[model samples]
Target: MLDLRSVEIGYGIMDHARNQGYATETVGALIDWAFAFASVEQIHAECLVTNLPSISVLEKVGMRKTKEVDDRIKWILKRNSVNEA
Candidate 1:
């Protein structure tokens, strides 16, 4: 089980998995799993602003860019938002 409130999602593709849809698929499933609990108001993830591929995956998984501090971009997936989709 994951504690959505405190959990941070991190993902990276190995050389063999690069250019494939595995990262997106895995993040999508994790988002679904994170939002499974009623107490999970939102899920958070962060990536370096320079990581365009990672940013793309987060966006594709329904996470919105909520904050940016220095080189990091923070994304959030709200439970209510996902439920409405």
Candidate 2:
């Protein structure tokens, strides 16, 4: 079962719109919204190792590697950890 304190994030950009920062901006905005507007304590995301763009988005938004299950990497960001200096 999914944790009540956490939510999973996912996004897809069309082929024609790749690399224009939509995925990164949208994911970051959603993270901020979740932490600001709800009781969410953490957020999770998963992407394949070969998905460079998705990896970049996750990193840019301050997510950290949690684990690798099979061929996918699990990433996470906690509410207390957002915008840390």
> Which predicted model would earn the best TM-score?
2
Among all windows of 10 consecutive residues in model 2, the one with the lowest summed lDDT is: 76-85
Poorest stretch of ten by lDDT in candidate 1 = 1-10
Total backbone collisions, model 2: 0
lDDT of 1 by residue, 6-85 (tens): 45688879988877899999998888786676676788899999999999898887889988999999888877788554
Q: Which stretches of candidate 1 lie over 4 Å from their true place?
A: 1-6, 83-85
TM-score, every prediction: 0.85, 0.93
What is the C-alpha lDDT profile of model 2 across 36-81, one tens digit per residue?
Answer: 8567999999999889889999999999998888989999999888
| CA RMSD of each candidate after superposition | 3.1, 1.3
What C-alpha lDDT values do all the predictions have?
0.82, 0.89
**Alpha carbon lDDT at 73, candidate 1:** 95
